[model samples]
Target: MNRKNLTHKAGRDNAEPVGGGGRIRPVNNPREATKTRPAGGKDAKSTGIDRTRNFCIIAHIDHGKSTLADRLLDLTDAVPERERMEQILDSMDIERERGITIKAQAVRLVYRREENGDGGEAEYMLNLIDTPGHVDFSYEVSRAIAACEGALLVVDASQGIQAQTLANLYLAMEQDLEIIPVLNKIDLPVADVEAVTEELVELLGVDESEILKISAKTGQGVPEVLDAVVDRVPAPESAVEQTRGLVFDSHYDAYRGVISLVRLFDGELAKGDRVQAMGSEEEFEVLEVGCYSPKPTALPKLGVGEVGYIIAGLKDIEALRVGDTVTKVEDPAESVLPGYAKVLPTVYSGIYPTVGDDFERLRDALQKLQLNDASLFFEPENSRMGFGFRCGFLGLLHMEIIQERLEREFDLDLIASSPSVKYEVVLQGGETVEVTNPSDLPEVFEEIREPMVRATVICPKEYVGQVMGLCHEKRGVSVGMEYISTKRVQLTYDLPLGEIITDFFDALKSRTRGYASYDYDPKGYVASDLVKVEILVSGDPVDALSFIVHRDKAYYRGRAMVEKLKELIPRQQFEVPVQASIGKRIIARETVRAYRKDVIAKCYGGDITRKKKLLEQQKAGKKRMKQVGNVEIPQEAFLAAIRI
Candidate 1:
């Protein structure tokens, strides 16, 4: 590889990130920014790698890639059990409760070379990339595979091949990554190792003898898996070729500032050194350097083909993101490495302060979160809901996690809009207007296009009718349907992404008796009329009510959202008018009557302190409300409106 390849692009602008992973702000590693321009194109030059082993874990959800990693750290004595994390969730709180790795997490595992040769003095650095298996987060798996040379595919022996298991294998194959099959969960009584072996051979085209059977739950087969990684995954061409490293990820710690995750292709990183991120000017001292023991370990240096975390003064992880690079002392690679072409976000929502005076607090919480989740793009936004942020995420779950994080992690209350996809209106003049919030829909647009969702649902044949009925209710069209097994059918549909962001999936499953599984990907947009539909009680316009709907169904869904709002909202002293609109013009309208009675029904003469306390509580509650012009919008009003 030409060293100039990594250096030539030093002056060029950092490219955009595309697909489900999405883009983050750029941070140039100072060492990387000074590299000479590449002779050919933007690409990292290879480094010496007698110390390289690249591999990704491919397994269905709950197959325990994280658990296995925990054991790997302990088995290798990479870090004392006191320092290392048990499950490398690297995941936020929401991810753990949801039981999925929303983002692909990478870490370096240092294993002692006792099995292979050289009297076991040689230590092997295993770059372990854990990819998410859920279809919703499949894009994360793609990037994980891109950074690896091989895959340690874990399959449950009793369960054999799962839907996502097959999905991930297909992804791994596309990357041409060497596959080391491992049958896990052998600790179960019904574990059928032979059956799973045959299934793997037939489905993945792997030899039966190649599959290593293990019980990840019991720490079995982990050693063999680690050994296979060293033998099967070839080291980087050269770990000492050049001063090049790839910025595969970044995270922000309140105390550590910027913690950048990188794969060193050549050279090493040390403490008390000045360095810059690959794309931006954010510089930091090598506060600490350690392999992704998921625990902070103070190591002297990291060699090529190793994944490690760098804590710098630059705490904004977005700046030092995936597909970036690191170098020694302002000497970067010829050009920065490319991860995915660029990241594009499809789902969006509005987040606002639910209570008065918490606007700044909510904004602070969101900014703090953006420090870690670079994919969750956000900006200052003012809305009828309140002064807040308009955030973008990879998918609905991505959006939900950030919201949950804001509330749970930061303890700030917020009001959010239902998730929506960008709607592009290709006008007659070949121009397009992108609509995220329904309030942004252009006025009198001739041709409006909104996102259509593509979903694959698995439900029992007996409940097929129930599922189909639910689909039709959401105006989803059955484009294709197939039988996945004797009792299950996979149905494909195209619906508005907005329609199902809320309870559509839940309702589908509930109506079908929990037999339906739903997965969706945005399938572009369909041309339809959308409006800034506002809901009002009595005659007051409640800004919290908004939706993107076709002109045909706008009346019903709009009315439904308003009616539901009425039930959720407490009647006020004044009447409220719930009206739906397109710009200033009202298309449909509804109204909720004012409160007939609100004053306390009984007041005994003796309890003076109790009455004072009740009145104080009422005053405090009033302080929490937002004063929207003449309306004292209740805090619970916004929360109740979009809780789902």
Candidate 2:
């Protein structure tokens, strides 16, 4: 259909018929329809399986995945003009402000195709999943890819391909999903469409003509993208006969309980039906069934090959997981579907509420957030800072986003410990244990193994030397290097994950002038001379300030920590010494001078004997105070030490 003629009029009767005589009835007011829609009666007819297309958009950060989604919605008239906005699918405030997609979002669009000479016009159902581009949220992309049959591989025409582009491409290829190459941001003044097309041709092994060049910002050639999806992408195929659906995503609703977004593989699910989560083995009566046309619109039932949401009044947050399988309780599937692999957090930290009384509130907030973010892992623990939770995150960005959400959404002030990686400790008894917190490290260990990752750095050839220098400083070992194009190069190295988790990305960006793109995969652990450095204030070791570092660099890191602590700790009535030690050996030390009370000031003109007597008495009092006085460490000191 022509782009100009693709508009959907609200409340219009006798709408055009889709394939198999299904009508394309567009709901003008979704909120009203949701409230008035009946349960299990006069349900909307399902479009034929042959006319349904399920696909997701995958790209590097800021490569315009969300922009392209907006254009598609505009072309299909899926969103009302008054309510339309840029990055509409990014529902979170943090996402819109940062211009990134943290969570994967799914929306259903209805498109009407033009009639050919021999065939009549037909309406097609397009299900589009917009996925995040950052490496930390790659798990979300993987789950989205599993639910779709095709992916739109978006590339920036001016920047060509990037590290994440290859990473996401490999993910889609693993699922054997059909990939449609598209070059975005072609309207830029310096956009080298030909060069990028050549890069795409070499990487995808597709002809130059196969790549679609369009400017998502201006809505140029967006309608053609929809046509390509309908013509090139295949329909979903279900092998199972019994009812089965994949719960690709879910979130906790305070009013409705846990609402799950699922892709139906076989059979149908209707409101009031009893469904069971294969993973949790929990059954609940379905309270509602609907689809997201940018907004929740209630439907009577969801059919095979259809994507929609299910509200079963699941009060237990753990009852429905993101990668679980949902099936009818009465006629359940013989077996559970192949769910996604469990993602383990790579970075660890201690998240403690600023107010100790908010511990339960923090726990409740985390439980609700975990319901939405399956990758977040946490457990209760006690440290010198009092009761807190040791949380695990995918990466530093993921950690920042979660902490930010907790503060904004739950109104809780929190302090996060320095990010650390899991380490393997082998004891003298020939036993090994995992250590995520430095304070948990044993007093004596035979050896320590630190986690490592295989990192990929893509940049211009001129900056290759700077990138390599930065990597080498982080203890990286070069694996290989090659030229992806005449002007761009790709560098591969193996570096410790602990090193990359702290300031590595920022250093790389500064060294490359923000032209480098980085991605990494875990390569397990390797034996290293690791030592746990303990920070002591006034002869007392602060467990919260301890950290693990390589033996060779322990002295320098310890010195830096003590120096920073000296500047942060407040002056006390008695001398306070800050020291960094490894076991019994002291590596670094700094002192915060005590506040002196001039006893001699009162006897300025007195005899020498009287001044001496006053001085002796003052010295004796100071010694006594030093013996019994307690030094209070401020919160700023802890934050500074962790950052250092």
Candidate 3:
């Protein structure tokens, strides 16, 4: 390698000749490379001028998301000096372990396709947003989809379309983005392109010609899909005003405080702009303004149709709300932000510390989570299980993920209550109540209106009997059941929102296996004989243990909940009563039998270590629980009962 070659190399790998297209060649002369190599070496791609694109892919899980990304990197020559397929983008630790996308990952690639209508077959940046597929991570999916103007709906040719696939597709449509249907998994023998296309036309109501057949695994049809994305997905029509941008997402950065993910709806973000977001009056001289292709880098400016990150010189994430508008301090944008939707905090749950003294850690985790999720609302609320937070979530999955994240990410043990739906009630004294906790229920008879849900169940016509039976069991009133085709039927029900929420959907699926597809929306509230079945661990009522059920269903519901609690509730030093009661009458009762074996007998040798460990474990366990006379209360005992 000569000095002239080292001049272009700038940092490392002087012996590795630069390819014609500015790609790095494999290191041939180790000595020359070693001599020129900079301290840790530079990112071959990241070190070069960053390629930028703003787009998100929408597909069901297992429709070759990460594989498609892997192929793009290869075809675009994004990887060099390593034969390793290297990263699969979403193949993060959790994703690889679980084989599911838990978070959205961003990356940059150049399709370098025939430009077609844009003058010449040109090279343009392609920003790929790969998101999660499970229902629990739908918020992450929605966030990723919103970042792109075009969504490539990857449908499995073999598996056909799934309920969740349609759910995401409908959301993409609702966002009014261009929909490009790609038939994935054509390499498999079971690939049914025709069947899936027909379903897309009939079920999704998409035009037949709009679908493209592709295989992300065999590296087949991927280029065509890329072409479809460019030709079909329109360029962003209008840029947001001169305002900075609205905070689309955010996260807590240990050193950077809160790093906000902002989509440039309009205007340009310069290096030193002071922006106002939410009600927060922090004037942040923009420390760094660049788009995140999953990897953050400094950029000159972000125009319309760009997704990027902002490092505001502030430590509090609460200042930059997810849905709040961002405006430059001087001469703010005149027009209001576009397509601003009211993201209501729907369900509420109590997130308690199972290990007892991790309350501060729980708050810290929540603060970090809230930095990215503006719609999440949580505050300190006291329960019988000591002090915990009554946290708001978008849905059940949101509640579960937060709990899981606290445990997995923060190493804080948690006991969570069944999610409680927000209720609207008219009190006897003419005051209407919106209650989250069942403990807030009015003791006296009043017009109580629990939220009602409108749900449509798609199932085999022959199974309508079982479906109807299941719905009726949940106190569901069927509007009608219509046959779409020979074997398929759509059943409409106006059921108590509580019924649909609590294990009902899971039960419905269990009853039908993976075949039934259901969709639901909140239908305000309706008057019903609602009562809070209070669960008393011994004589004291555990507010965290209460569940609001219709008077008609309370008896059985309470009985099952109490029965489950009995199996889980720790045995007491003395006999303990776990009972569910409505008003003054006890409806269900279960007992935590007296401790037959809580203490270990004295032992010898290695047995002494086990016995002493058990004794210490028992002592530590006592600190986590409330001892009522002889009765023992487990932190999860109350949460386990709600079943929501």
For all candidates in order, the CA lDDT equals 0.64, 0.83, 0.66
Residue 521 displacement (Å), model 1: 4.1
Measured against the true structure, the TM-scores of the candidates, in listed sequence, are: 0.77, 0.89, 0.79
Runs in model 3 lying further than 4 Å from the true structure: 1-53, 60-70, 77-98, 114-121, 134-145, 203-207, 239-243, 278-281, 355-357, 460-462, 480-487, 595-630, 636-639, 642-644
Cα displacement (Å) at residue 635, model 2: 4.6
Q: Can you rank all candidates by TM-score, best first? A: 2, 3, 1
246-278: candidate 3 lDDT, tens digit per residue: 565777877878787776655567778777773
- Scored against the true structure, residue 7 in model 2 reaches a CA lDDT of 22
lDDT of 1 by residue, 330-433 (tens): 66555655545455677778888767699888766776665555456788877766687778877766776777778898888777776667788766678887
Candidate 2 has a TM-score of 0.89
- Give the range where candidate 2 is weakest over 10 consecutive residues by summed lDDT: 18-27
Clashing pairs in 2: none
| Number of the top lDDT candidate | 2
Show where candidate 2 strays beyond 4 Å.
1-47, 117-121, 593-604, 607-642
* Per-residue alpha-carbon lDDT of candidate 2 for residues 62-83, written as tens digits (9 for 90 to 100): 8999999999999999999999
